[model samples]
Target: MTAPLPPLVRLPLLALLIDAALVVLFVLIGRASHNEGLLGTLVTLWPFLAGLVGGWLMIRAWRAPFSIAWTGLAVWAATVVLGLLLRVASGQGVQLSFMIVTTIVLGVFLLGWRGVVLLVGRARVRRAALLATAKRMSTAG
Candidate 1:
């Protein structure tokens, strides 16, 4: 029987899945806005997907999957830059307006979740510290 992976190993996988899903959601929204059909979703999505995987590999995101600064920024950059470049190479449209929208939307979707996680983690730590301080004060009083 195979042993289950530890939390450290599992977390990166979860992060990658979340990132990929958000990228897909980005593509879906864009395609839907254009009145494009689901049949061409993969056709439209591959460059961005390729870029996302490349980003994860380039930054070794597995090392710090939840680090918004470390992992999220690199992933967002690679997804946008490479995705756009690949689209140009693949003879897809690369208009200024589209590029702007792509950059903004992908940035939000990719980094937004990580930002929330970071904030939540910070809040939890702060709450814990406050509780500890309160407990200490009560005990001393």
Candidate 2:
């Protein structure tokens, strides 16, 4: 059997999965707000999902899924644009208010997690550096 992948390798894959889940969450929340049936999930899901896939493919997101500026922005843009376009082509409503709401909410969902990850990673690095410096000083003194 192949050895388990390292955490570093697994992280990007995890990020992709998170992004997809967030997109689905966005759809579900909107549908619920509108009193739409859960049975109609796929009808609402495909457009945003397609846009999400397009975003991932366009940026080769696996290469840098942790990057907010790189992966997050591109993914947000593609998902919103394509989702809107597909919604129109599919004869769904596309009011200005809905467009604004979708853009803001998806931006927060897609990019917010990445921002949190970046902050956590930075904190860990700083803590490690401080510990190392303290150790060196103690040993020297």
Candidate 3:
């Protein structure tokens, strides 16, 4: 059997996959809302993907794959800003309202999962600590 991947490699790969999936979902939803067919949506996917890649590079996202402050917020902001800039540059219409909507939606999509993960991680740590304390008390008693 092949050896398992180290956390260093696996975590970054997982983070990249999750972030890319969120970006694609954001694009698909936006296009669907406007009744843009699948083919049309596919046509517009590149700009967002470009922004996502730009964000990943700017943040060096792999360094702290699970950090909301360092990774989530930075990535979300970069994705929206860079995506819109690219959209404008590519002759795609980007109205003020569209910008606002995209920002809010992508913010939720990208950061929501990170927030959940943070909460769960905290809970796990707390639980483990409590268990450790209980075990020590039981043993001492």
Instruction: Estimate the Cα RMSD of every predicted model relative to the unseen true structure.
Output: 1.4, 1.8, 1.6
lDDT of 1 by residue, 54-88 (tens): 99999999999988887999999999999999999
What TM-score number comes out for model 3? 0.91
How many clashes in each candidate?
0, 0, 0
lDDT, model 2, position 138: 98
Clashing pairs in 2: none
- Model 3, range 43-132, lDDT digits (tens) per residue? 677888889889999989989977888898999998999999988998999999989988998899889888898999999999999999
- The TM-score between candidate 1 and the true structure equals 0.92
Q: Give TM per candidate.
A: 0.92, 0.90, 0.91
Residue-by-residue lDDT tens digits, candidate 2, 31-140: 88766686677788888999999889988888889899988999999999998999899988889998999999999999999999999999999999999999999999
Query: For each candidate, what is the lDDT?
Result: 0.93, 0.91, 0.88
Evaluation by lDDT, superior candidate among 2 and 3: 2
Highest-TM-score candidate = 1
lDDT of 1 at 3: 100
Worst 10 residues of 1 by lDDT: 32-41
Candidate 2's C-alpha lDDT? 0.91
